[model samples]
Target: MSAGLIDVHAHWLPAELFGLPSGSPYGAMRDQDGELFLGDLPLSIRTEAMSDVNAIISDMDAHEISLRALSPPPFAFAVNSSSEDYIDEYNASLSKVVTESTGRLAGLGLTRLDDASAAARQVADIAKAGVLAGVAIPPMLRGASLDVGVLRAVLRSAAQHRLAVLVHPMQLPRPEWSSYYLANLIGNPVETATAVASGILGGVLGELPDLRICFVHGGGCAPAILGRWSHAWQARADVRAGSSIDPRDLFRSAYFDTVTHDLAALELLASHAGEDRILCGTDYPFDMAEPNLPAFVDSTGLDRVALQRSGKAFLGVRVPQTELQ
Candidate 1:
């Protein structure tokens, strides 16, 4: 078997997901054009490709990518007013896509953030259906904290079922984010770091050691800012009261993907998060996705063997057996 690259942070939606009236009445998303909008702001994604797995596979082939860990684009999870039929349809469609892909694709599931029990059930059900890479989540669902009991229930269930967690931000942090694609560039990392800290500072990471999570966008500066976060934790008793452990000391439980789009950022992520905690990723079919992951890895200053090892440990991707030798 030949060595293959796993783009672990890619996004995809079942074709049926698009063009449907949102239960949340996300009227902006249902404008008949199938375009993406963050906080009612339109994005530039080509809606047609989102539902087309063949187009996605062609993209993988062109990029020499063997497998992509597909997740519902963040918008899908924003459907706060979803119906059971809607949720079931989304999960089943995801499983169907992965099942038909013949090992070229794996998927993550979408769940409700407002209701933890429902989210837990969704996670287990999706896992039972063989869609096991993990489940898709936003940094903060609506305005709730990941550290809250409701979200904790979901993580605990994730631990029980052995499903990985993947985090993305649902919307930009501020109205100003509408300018310069700031949501994807700035809000994305900010949200990731904040969510990761909830696990680290909230004691959830220590409680659920079996849980595995991969943060997209090179962990969005969490690796770059550990020193600041650590200092704050030490300088303020209030901050220390949150986790009491050094900020740098506990993030070994966290995993990150190589979507930083900067070689320097990738190096910082590997060093800060540990080389093994970093995995291959490409936010495919989106403008910000790395164009050439193989090339990015080759030039990131980290050794190929170590990076590959780290990705394998974090993702547990099953490459062809011939390559295992």
Candidate 2:
């Protein structure tokens, strides 16, 4: 494993958050046949791997990943409710995991998006905790865009604290995307693209210039539509109503993870977003994750070392050069 190989996009769930009893304050979650289900809907499979720190570290070692930044998957965000208590418990559990990893893991805390002021306070608390590199947020809050109202305050707080923000998608099942797992394969990317557009066209990126936000899944479909957005920005008045910042420039300023699952697509993203803005991400322990991230990047013909450096920059942490034995 390269000493500086760091994965900025990965997920971890503490055992305390799952397998809940009926009267639990955080709601009931059950583990049925090794699959985690919240109510009648299945939340995730591979529950063991998600909660097991040792297994995660071993998998990272096997895949030549020297370090990983862990966040709870979007399902754990509890975005539908104003449940700061659950968010607090989740972040506290994650901090303990980071401390136990012995330099192999860094944590990204969770925040309740329903309350903007509370969310900002959570960001401040996460920074003060001194163990988390950033915070993970869903692309939407209660069916509205991220830039809609008070959400911008959350982004502003993140920037002021110098903490990175991971914009992951927690896609709800739509009627049109019901079959063939389109909810994840198609809905997820669309959701991410929506968030990216909202951030750019709505002026969140321009307002918070210091915010270090990274979108996963190769920034969804945002890269492919940059030219169209740029054209609309220049040719249409309504498109320019929200903010005067060019969508292309705002897109370039943000960071993206290498999870496009295509060499040409990744090359296109790096070319436009700049090599320094591309970070290594595996979406680890999920069935949709890249099975062998190092090998996949090597096949892309992009510079792995540059991606390593980009991961370091996004996290704002210096990882020592220590090769795995």
Candidate 1 RMSD to the correct structure? 2.7
Each candidate structure's TM-score, on Cα atoms with residue i matched to residue i, is: 0.89, 0.92
CA shift at 226, candidate 2, in angstroms? 1.1
Per-residue CA lDDT of model 2 for 1-325, tens digit only, reads: 4444689899888777774322322355566787766677676567677878988998888888888999887777766666666778888888888888888898888876767788888889889888899999888776667687556777889999999999998766889998988988999999999999999998889888889999999999889988899999999998998889889888888999999999988988887798889988999877689888989888887676777778888888777744321
Candidate 2 lDDT for residue 145: 71
Highest TM-score model number: 2
lDDT of 1 by residue, 21-113 (tens): 254433434323666544465556666557688888998888767777888777677446545676677777887888889988888877766
RMSD values for the candidates in order, in angstroms, are: 2.7, 2.8
Poorest 10 consecutive residues of model 1 by lDDT? 23-32
The list of candidate 2 runs beyond 4 A from truth reads 1-4, 19-29, 37-44, 321-325
Candidate 2 residue-wise lDDT at 69:
96
